[model samples]
Target: MKKAALLSIAMLGLTACSQGVQTMTDRTASPCGDKPNCVSTQDNREKYQLAPFTLTANASLDNIEEVALKLPGAKTAVKEGGYLRIECTSRIMRFVDDLELKIDGRTLVVRSESRVGYSDFGVNRKRADQLREQLKQSGLIE
Candidate 1:
């Protein structure tokens, strides 16, 4: 009983340490906050840099938004201009990760980052890739 209680408390403490959304500046999403739990086309760091995907002729902002919403634990948190911000929670721990998709010219730029912690075991990267695949499968991206 004592061990279980201690474990619960430790998990709660870790969850409480997660930070929320960081500010985005200009037309780019914020860079990773000294953490490996983030990846973005806006970031120049080799570990964080991801290529922006080109949009298909049939793709619209709504189509991309729909693809994001279909992902597990994902919800649209904000939509403005050509940017869509999504929040995804972990299945068990409920840790939140933020994903931003921006329409820059003819390409779609994506940024995914964990709300807290220095490592995410590649969850953010995998999530981004999953989203990209969904877009492609749905003919939203080429």
Candidate 2:
């Protein structure tokens, strides 16, 4: 009877382990079985990749704002103590609003939703035709 009870408990443990198992697709996205330990990209999909150009004033939000805007990476920044929304893409990333001045640090958060990726930022982009014309006139391009 003890042996049978041990086997039943083992089976229950195995079932519990598989309860929340999930599967995710990578860049190639072939069906891959994700274990229970797998972290869902959307369910746990809040992601950020931030580095400071120069963190001064003890990593307050303001100091880090501008340089991050000009660069390819800053996923988000604090402006006017409000969240500055940005969209990113491989070709270009653009600002969602004019600079807000609430930030006082150098560390920036490069974050995104599960449905959003850096490449999706291109949808909102427009080329700088004026700059292109200037460059052409300057003989920078044929």
Candidate 3:
């Protein structure tokens, strides 16, 4: 009985930590939560807000996808219309973080958030910055 209860609790914890794409919309990536574990181009909070990537004339969703996939532990999980979702896992703890991108006219909106933690130790912000630099290097974004 004790073993069964422990198994159930473990499953519940994993389920909570594996949530994905909770607040995305057709036109934008999801907003950052009140926690510091997120950063988004659509967020109004100074600490959580990042500038949307300005797509160059030659840039496409394919270019963005290719650039994003080069990030550490990044894998494309969803691609539909102008939206793309990439799951990035931490190397040690294997914590999954959702990195979402939405094409909006000449720009790419972005949101990166941890699934379960209150603080990601700036991991989400660093991931976004790394992606931005790669996009710029590839001439995909200005």
Which number leads on TM-score?
A: 3
CA deviation > 4 Å runs, candidate 2: 1-58, 73-78, 92-110, 113-142
The C-alpha TM-scores of every prediction are: 0.80, 0.25, 0.83
Please give the CA lDDT of all the candidate structures: 0.83, 0.30, 0.87
As a TM-score, model 1 comes out at 0.80
Question: What order do candidates take by TM-score, descending?
Answer: 3, 1, 2
Per-residue lDDT of 33-60 in model 1, one digit per residue for the tens?
A: 6778988888888888887789988888
Question: 1 or 2, which is superior by TM-score?
Answer: 1
The parts of candidate 1 lying over 4 Å away from their true place are 1-27
Error at 24, model 1, angstroms: 7.5
Q: Report the lDDT tens digits of candidate 2 across residue range 21-119.
A: 133212111111232211111223222111222223344443334333443433442234523433233333222211112222332222322222333
Stretch of 10 with least lDDT, candidate 1: 18-27
The candidate maximizing lDDT is 3
